[model samples]
Target: MKVKYWTCHSDGCAANVHIDKNDHFIKSHGQHHHIPEPEQIELRNLKGKVKERVITETSSITKIYEEELARSNLSSTALTLAFTAAEG
Candidate 1:
């Protein structure tokens, strides 16, 4: 499955937002703050400082996934069974 995400450009804010495929907000880091206006939302190529923020957010997502997996009791076998059940 493909997961969608949003990365905002704001200083001291490494807010990596995970969203549903339909663009519905799922979760985020940094702060539960409101999103900026479209004009305020910086749109630029990944370079220098912006690149650093991207790397940091990527690492944060990895950590979050690891924590979630550890807390969940489902094993690989159980996940397979669940997928099969859903498919049927």
Candidate 2:
């Protein structure tokens, strides 16, 4: 393919930038093509990872927690009282 594929070097840009093999710029397409600050991209990625991990782990444990809760004989009031006593 003689087409040179290019993308916005910006972290936040979802734009498609293209060029020809002849070193001629083809076109850059997007409503927003501004570059994101370095720290912002780092933080944004970190937050996304954390959120993904949390959702994954939570989904894995949710069924286990629900099963245990269902098997328990203790009422909500009794559980609360026990928890309060344990805290003291």
Best by TM-score: 1
Work out candidate 2's RMSD over C-alphas. Answer: 16.7
Put down candidate 2 lDDT per residue, 1-88, tens digits, no spaces.
4777766566777777678888788877775556444544443444455455557676644454344434444455544543454358
lDDT of 1 by residue, 15-48 (tens): 7888888888888766625666432221121122
All candidates: CA RMSD (Å)? 17.8, 16.7
Q: Give the TM-score of candidate 1.
A: 0.33
Q: What lDDT score is found at residue 45 in candidate 1?
A: 18
- Give the CA lDDT, 0 to 100, for residue 58 in model 1: 62
TM-scores for every predicted model: 0.33, 0.31
Q: List the residue pairs that clash in candidate 1.
A: none
- Estimate candidate 1's RMSD in Å: 17.8
